[model samples]
Structure formats: C-alpha cells, structure tokens
Target: MLKRTISMTAAGAALVVAAVAGCGSNVQPIQVKLAAAEVLTQAARKTAQVTSYTVDAVVNVKHPQQGGGKMQGRMVYQSQPQLAADLTLDTVDMAGRSLPGGARAVLQGDTLYVKVSALQDLLGSSKPWIKVPLTEQGGSTEVRQLLDQIQRFDLGNMTQLVTASQDVKAVGTESVNGEDATHYSGTFPVDVAVQQLPADRQEQARKGLAEMEDVAFDIWVAADGLPRKLAMNGSKQGATLDATLLFKDFNKAVSIEAPPADQVGELPQSAPTN
Candidate 1:
C-alpha cells in the first residue's frame, strides 16, 4: 500500500512545489528579498556540482473528503544526471491513521519502480499509480527541475512568480542558523504565474495555474555563492504549504547509473494504449 501511495504521490507530487509558500504583507521589504534571491542564484551557479542531496521531507496528505495525514522520512539521493540515481529512503517512517507504513521507490531514468505489500495494494487499487512514459512525462523531477528553476533568480525570472513588478528592497543583514544572512521583502505583482504543469504541458494552460501568489522566499546564500537555506510559504484554495530547505555537506560527486539487472523488475518499456 505504501508503494502505491508513493506512485500516486508521484503524480500529485509533480505539482507539490507549486502548492507551497505565500507572500506575507510588508514582511521584510522588496530589495532585501530580491538581493537574497540574487545571492542564492549566484551561490547555485558557483557550486561546482551537486551530485547528491539528503532530504528530510515531511509530507502531509490531505483530501477534501478525507481528513489528512503526515509522514516524514529521510532520503539520500545520488544522481549522475541523464543516468540514474541510487535513492535510498532511510529512517522511513510515517504516522496518520489512514496512511500506510513506510514507503520506498527506485526511480531510474524515467521508470519509477515501486514496491507495495498486498494489504497496501488494496488501498490504491482503484487509483492510477504509474504515469505516462518518461518521454511523455517531460522534464520534471526533484533534482532535474532545480537546474532550470534556479536560473529564475536573475530577478527577471524571480519576478514572474513573486513580487516582481514591485521594487525589491533589502533589509539589514542578520545571522541565520549561525551564518551571516541578508533579508528582503516586497509586494507581489498583481499578476504572476507559477508553473504547475509538467514542462511539456505548461504551455497549454489557462486558469488554476498553481497557488504561487503572494509568496516570498527567505533565501540564505553562503558568501561563497552556495545556498545554505531557504524558507517559502504561500496560500491557495484556503490551504497553505510552507517549506524550508537547508543545504549543507554539499561535497559529493554527482553520479547516476542504470539500475542493476537484479533491481530492474519486469516493466514494459512502453505504456499501454486503449
């Protein structure tokens, strides 16, 4: 059942990043925020490469009909770019009466190999867990997407999502988690669009574009041009998702390899048609 959830989660999760964060009023100032964002962009560019990342993600599952559940887990992701990554879900644990036990998935290239127990299988049996082929899914994955999104830091790209039209003012500098950091804030542009669809489908949209409105990020970039921390909060449909990411120990070689023969299960190379 957990495996099925992961599969289902993958689909819903595709737009999860869009669903988080909000823009608070006069929170900090425009210049402060823009500068912080610029700093983060510079840090990302300066970094030699990010081979792997350790993520402690706490996922809250909610449905209009069903209440909600929270699950948290630590993941070590290794990537070799166009290749595959050895993603390990460690300390896998979750709680929430309706949710299942821990979950795991081995995603190589475009294939997301999920394993679920028979009992859990019954939970999502009626729902679609897998997705269209990777070729069809387009360019969207935790690691891969960052490469493009980070470029938006040029203020031009950042403005498209947040208070871009308004002036960005920089607040005074302060210490965040022991690192000297700068703060910023601004008014959101009345019209800003956040990318919520898969890259390929993003161009074919209209209403309900993702709730990236009135949102701002507290980005912490190291003096050396590396992102050390980020805080984002936003609201939509009467719901809010706040996320914070702190990067450290950024010294592993980026590497991804095809799944070992033993780990590669029997999966059809193509999706079935009606």
Candidate 2:
C-alpha cells in the first residue's frame, strides 16, 4: 500500500508540473519581454542543438494540508533520434517514512517501467521490475488514467517556457551544483506558455492548470549557455507546489533499454498499468 501511494504521488507531481506550464486563473498573462527574453531565446536554441543530457535533481513538494515529500534523483534524457529517459531516484520521503530502496522509472515513448527493489519475489518472481505499458497493450482503465496525466512531463517544456517568457533577466552569478551559473528570475506567463502547446494539447493543458495562480519560475544557465537548473513555484487558494530540475553532462552518451525480459513483470491490474 505504501509503495502504491508513493508511486501515485510521483505520477501526480508530473501532472502538476504540466499544469504549471500554463492554464490560468487570477493569473495574469506573460508577454515574453524583450531584454530577458533574448537570454532565454539564446539558451533555448543552444539546448535544441544538443543530443542527450543528464540531470541531477532535487525536488520538494507541498500540498495544502497533507504535508509533502523530498526526492533526490538523476535522469538521463535523450532527444536526438528519439525520446527516452532513464531515472534513478536515490531518496524519496513522501510525508511518511522514507522509501527503503528508492525507485527507478524509465520512460520510452509511451511505455513506463518502474522498479522498486532488486528482487520482485513479492510477485512470485525474482524479476525486480514492474512494467507499465501505457499503450493499449495491457493495463486497467484506472491505471492508464493516472499514468496518462504524467505524459506531458517530457522536460521539453523548458523550451516552451523560454520561448514564451517575457522578463527573466540576470539576477547574479551563483554556483549551481558545482559550476558557476547566471541566475535569472521572472514570473512565467501561464497563459502564454500554454498557448505554445500543440493545438490538440492546449485544452487539456489549460484544464490541468486551471486552478493555479501566482506563478513564479527561475533558471540558471552556465557560461556555455546550457541551463543548469530550473525551478518553478505555483499556488492557488489552498495548495502550493514547488518543483526544480537540474541539468548537467550535456550531449551525454546514454542508451535506454527496458529491463531484461526475464527480470520484468507486468504491473498488476490492481496498481496502475502494464
């Protein structure tokens, strides 16, 4: 039960980040101002030229009354010929006790694989991996619904935010992770950011962020133009969520593959999917 709770919460966090990109309320629009916007413009173009990258991230979450959690993880994301990510979360504390062995989540196209331990003996197999097939291949409707919400969190939203931003000028230089970086601050225009989404995705994206207001975000870029850190904070009447992701090792060589066939099992109909 605890595992299920943690997994679902992680999925929910992804959905929230998607909503924060856009969707309005008492939230005013952002114009993507000229001065600061140019900085982001350059950064965006530089990032677009890269192939793959690694992110060493630390994220904190807060809910209205339920408290929150902390997660320290690393992600290897590839976008050249294809899109995929391999993630290893070393620490997760979701309002309760910290997760024992942390967790692993891999995303390849529409498929997601999650592993909680080095052994899956709990399911009668020593496999250690639980596969969640986001497609129609297999999975219950409920499971699919929850996983579907996380689909928009591809980390590419940084591009959209930069392109749509108005005022994000340099604040000062700060050391991010270990490298020197230029810190920039601005209030991201939720409406403008949402408009950047593809037509088919616009409505859903707006709906997801409909209840949010007072959005603020910042990003740190290195001398080479690569963003070292991205942080966003948003809140509504009773709830608030803050998220941050750090990027490193640009053009990192990585190969993302599913867990070994013999060491993976389908997600139980009881959980989410597979």
Best by lDDT: 2
Q: CA lDDT of each candidate?
A: 0.38, 0.61
Candidate 1's residue-wise lDDT over 1-274, tens digit each?
Answer: 3333343333222222222211111112123334554644444334324444444434343334434434344433444443332323222322233234434444455555443332234433332222213444442243233222221112222323433324445566667558776654544422433352235433321111234346545555545444445555555555444545444444355454443555334423332212
Worst 10 residues of 1 by lDDT: 20-29
**Deviation in angstroms for 209 in model 2?**
6.7
Question: Cα lDDT for residue 193, model 2?
Answer: 80
- lDDT of model number 2: 0.61
Q: What are the models' TM-scores?
A: 0.54, 0.74
